[model samples]
Target: MRRFFAYLTAFIREDFNLRLYAGTAAFVAAMTAFNYAVDLEDGIIDKHRGEVLRFWLYAGLDAFMYYSVTVFWLLANRQLSILKTARFWLFSLAAIGVLAWWQDYTGYSKVVGLPVFGEIYSFAHYCFSNLSSALTVWVPFAVFYLLVDRQPSHFYGFRPDWLSLKMYGILLLLMVPLIAWASFQPSFLQTYPIYKGWGAARALHWPEWIPAVIFELCYGFDFISTELIFRGFLIIGMMQVVGRGAVLPMVAVYATVHFGKPLGETIGSVFGGYILGVLAYQSRTIWGGIAVHLGVAWLMELGAFLQSFVHSPEK
Candidate 1:
């Protein structure tokens, strides 16, 4: 317990800027509330199949929100000149747009012959889709290290945590029952295993193992991206800018990202983000956050699968 408190104390002791943190949090909160309102409006409308103009519009808006919040704090710190930041944003957005578009292009245009559902093409698409978002966020960071920043990636705090495995294991074990019990909740069950849409899993024309394998890989990738962005990039990358204050706004944005997920999860994410952020700040690594995230995520997947396997009716 003494060790745990000490670890937390170090996390809080960093050279924090409270004003910057508060301003960033307010920006995220307002934007998130706006997004939620838009989402509610979108939910009420019925659209034709394959008509995703609304979806694209919302995605673009969300991207803009992310960019706004990101640049606000970076500007507050005055680390980079205006021209450099402009250049960074231009490259970063373009890369992400290309990756997002490439998913559709590769799935539709490049696959030999017409892409059929539940076939090899679909499986390839699913697997790559998992990795695409991770790569989109990762590329700029990598480029920054190699070309611009020139510091080791560890400067962004990707090293092994001082309390990595031990802390993660303890949290994982503690979360076991709460996560399992939530799995049985109607709201939770509905949103969980959000990877259900691949449909290839049930298309018996394909080998049974193919969809499962792709799904598991995608599942792992989703959490990896989540950790890298929220815990690694947001907290550590911004640490020099806002110091320990970075963690708060990161927590705000992190929790808001889960706004469309289950209510329990959205609420849980706020607490979980804080805990993981503290660990990342103290240990100088997001590895522990990744471990905790993956463990809890996989456990929820297993729990949801088991309930369905046992034919438990939704509560």
Candidate 2:
């Protein structure tokens, strides 16, 4: 117990040099205000025009929020020179804008070899969108790191620490009771297991496990992209430029993405993002964060599934 508190407090001393705690708070406030100004939804792609509109609207806003946070991060760190920053922003935002707009298509899947994907259309779409989204940051990051920033290796935040993973596992274990409690809440159950809208199995009439597997794969890939952007690119990539301040800004931006979640979760994400940022910076690995993220998500999904099964067997 004493050691745990020591590790917890020492995290601030060791990994929380970010003078940008206020900045993170400010960003979250501004984002909360913006969300109040609009109706945000998780993207749901469909041939119907209404769903397409929702996808572009939410995705465009999310892209703006995320990349704008990135710009603020680079500015605060001043990691790159004026010209380089300008160039980076121009191309990076352009890529995100173009790809997001492209995703608004009714025929996008067919154009991108969905016919070949056949039964795994959901998986293919998942791969295409997620990989494209990952590339939006990764490509420019690669060029900037290699050519401009001059990193020795492009490892990003992919470092692994098996011994330290125990620490993260413990953290997840500690959350089980809280998550279980939340599972009993109607609001929590309704909001969580967020992939129900995808409806891959019902739409395709395939085995339920097919969609479950695809969704999990998609969740895993998406989390990897997220870790790279926040923990890897923003935290580690900008560490030299901004010191520990990098983590806080990433935390702020991460919490912003959780805007549409329940109030408790959106608020919890602020701290969650901060902790993951610290873990990535200290261990120089996003694996622990990934494990915690996937574990928490699947656990939430399972909890929700169990509750629904017990109460509403028709579901």
Candidate 3:
């Protein structure tokens, strides 16, 4: 295990340079081509059916290909110390391959719109989307490594306790006010949609518990992936360079990701991302942010549920 880690480290440091970034760029390009390819075949039924196949192909296959190419390129560059140890590289590749496949199959990256390349101001759009969607994770990682990791010397006054449930409690407390404010707003109930299963409840109102659970369970996959990609991987990776200040980039990326959102909501999301980015940096764990993330998703789902209750004709 020690030797394997050594090789992995070497590979990452030496071979895993801008090539990985290039591979990711390729993934973006393929996704765009596939989408446009599908769109062009709108008239023919057989061609239209290819869209679904292409969606999975470009989405799933491309992710694996990207990861594989990066790893292989790292090995070829002799960046991996113990390329002699086939077990290590194989295991690492297998794990990431599985994760990439699962994420693609679930359509996690679908919302990350095509990067507008040179076409019609596409380059700017592409840059913004990439920066917003994936680059955010690199920032927090940089900050944690620079500021937090190097500060182990001041252990006694570090205030590690603040990184506990107290922080989580504070988050919950803050959420209460936002929830209250949203609930009281007349327009709050109409802003989001809640899907109700086709049942007797369609004809009349029913307890929202079931639909809330259903929606949360279903949509939660994509939500968690977004958090993992943006908050977990990107920020964590970037922390290697920028140290603690990486949160700034994370927030910027987070805000940009929501550019398609309404101004007020987009601004609010940036604030939320900033808060989550801090927690991630402080705790050195994405799980903390994931918990907060799940909470926010639940709140959104709850808000949707309340909307149903408020808007029902029976009400």
Candidate 4:
């Protein structure tokens, strides 16, 4: 047991730069506080109260925990630059659009708002949904560029363009089963069918070409934003101090960011983020990961757009 504890302690220290005793204590304290806030009284009168409290507790816990981890990783690695340059922001937006489209197509539009809201609320929600999803990519991208700013000179310069091509071929071959499984996972939440209103109710449902074009544009923003935040900022930032070992924190944080996702996508993201981080780190260029990321993302978005069109009774 002593040896086991030692091993566990060493693992956190090595993987997350976490000092075992203090980190363990901190985690326990946080969890205890979270649980206390979410506890329910065993009576009917408090049922709704309990549920609302639980919801808020979980939400707060998630946000706080994520922030804590990022802070911990940054401090351990000693990243001085918290904000990145303009070039990074530009690239990040491009990446977010591509990625967001891909996830949408893969039926990962779980982030979407419910279709039932009063006109003003719905209009505001729709505007925010598109706008927020479109712009939120900067968060992670800024983090990544800062983290990688101090990387050693020899970290980059590997070129296997042919290898990348071959790997993509393999991915294409495998994507058939992968996509099928991803698309059909059951959701308890029922999604609204495509509504064809213009502007306010502007149904994103119209000629496939028209909506597709608009979606593609929106998606470009969405995908790049996401990538910039996760792949570019969060992952890259952690890598500075963690070195190649940074993949540990990178995957953990990436998966958590998708905590809003369904189980399958969340699970998929853990593995996917790991692979993308490794590829990005190895190539010393985000290009390889970008290509793969963009390719998969676009395919997913296109699929979702088409499915909504085909399945919409109104259309």
Models 1 onward score TM values of 0.69, 0.68, 0.46, 0.50
Q: What is the lDDT of residue 180 in candidate 1?
A: 83
TM value for model 2: 0.68
Give per-residue CA lDDT, model 4, range 168-208, as digits (tens). 44555567565445444333113322223334434433454
Across residues 11-80, which tens digit of lDDT does each residue of candidate 2 receive?
A: 6765432544456567777777666455343322233343556456645655666555555655655654
Residue ranges of candidate 4 with Cα displaced over 4 Å: 1-169, 181-208, 304-315
| Index of the highest-TM-score prediction | 1
Candidate 3: what lDDT? 0.46
**Which 10 successive residues of model 2 have the least lDDT summed?**
39-48
Pick the lDDT winner: 2
Better model by lDDT: candidate 1 vs candidate 3: 1
Stretches of candidate 2 exceeding 4 Å from the true structure: 1-8, 14-27, 37-150, 195-206, 312-315
Residue 124's lDDT within candidate 2 is 58
lDDT of 1 by residue, 56-155 (tens): 5434544555556556655666644543645445534543343333222233224323445335455556566666664565775677557765555584
Candidate 3's residue-wise lDDT over 1-315, tens digit each?
233234335434533347544553454345334434554223222242324563454334433443343344444445454435554344333323333343223232333343432232322332233343233333433354366445443221122333444556556667866875776676765554333343423333555455345445645544555666555544454344334434443454454334334456656765577556655554555655655666766776577666667777999
Off-target runs (Cα >4 Å) in candidate 1 are: 1-4, 13-32, 40-125, 153-155, 195-210, 312-315
Model 4 misses residue 300 by how many Å?
3.5
